[model samples]
Target: MEKRTLGTAGPRVAPIGLGCMGMSWGYAESRRDDDTSIQVIRRALDAGVDLLDTAAVYGDGHNEHLVGRAIAGRRDEAVIATKGGLVVDDLATKQMHRDGRPETLRRQVEDSLTRLGIDRIDLYYLHRVDPAVPVEERLGRPRRPRY
Candidate 1:
């Protein structure tokens, strides 16, 4: 497959990526199936679509959990990109709020790592910039912490 990247220094990835949001949550809650979702993620990787896009508020971390299960043995083959700064307030209504404080980001990074079941995330996106927080504090240099 042809390869591209998010930026000059980002990891090389395929042009197409699979969004794992609808798999576990969102519009069709009744049709949600973990097994099928896992199969889809694996097939995407096998097909060279390494960019698996997910987010923390997508089903309130349900999407991350699904990705964690799908990439259990083949994490190296996938480029996982997940977003933070957004928290799900109501699943049914899909209401979300942004918290971009550095302290909140610190906790978010720890939580996302735990939910994704990985040591490092290929890309960590800020879902939304919290208006109450300073931009420098929320989107400054990558905060490297002991994992």
Candidate 2:
């Protein structure tokens, strides 16, 4: 498997990653299958595709839980990447609002960690920037967030 660094110094992962959004939300809900999604993720990991992309906004954390279950015993084989900074307004419609407030980010990170059943996330992304909150404050401190 071809591997590339995420940034200049980030973890090296397969060039292609698994985007897990459609597995838990979006597209046709009727065709969504948890079992299949889990299998797909596991297969990707087994094939050396370690970057698993998910988001807290995706299925309002449902996707994270699904990814968590898929990686269970093979956590070390996968590099988990998930996003936050969006608050789901309605699960059915997938309506969400950007909430990059420090408190919100803090809570969301903790919630995501719990849902993913991981002590630390390998990569955490801010889904969207909240216009209401200043970028610096929303991100916490300096250029990067403390957490």
Best by TM-score: 2
What is the alpha-carbon lDDT of model 2 when measured against the actual structure?
0.89
lDDT tens readout by residue for model 2, 4-112: 9887777889999999999988988678899999999999998899999999988888899999999999988889899889999999988989888999988989999
- On lDDT, the candidate that comes out on top is 2
- Residue-pair clashes per candidate: 0, 0
Weakest lDDT window of 10 consecutive positions for candidate 1: 138-147
Off by over 4 Å in 2: 142-147
Clashing pairs in 1: none
Local error of candidate 2 at 132, Å?
Answer: 1.4
Model 2 deviation from the true structure expressed as Cα RMSD, one decimal place: 2.3
Per-residue alpha-carbon lDDT of candidate 1 for residues 63-111, written as tens digits (9 for 90 to 100): 8999999999998899888888987789889888888988878788888
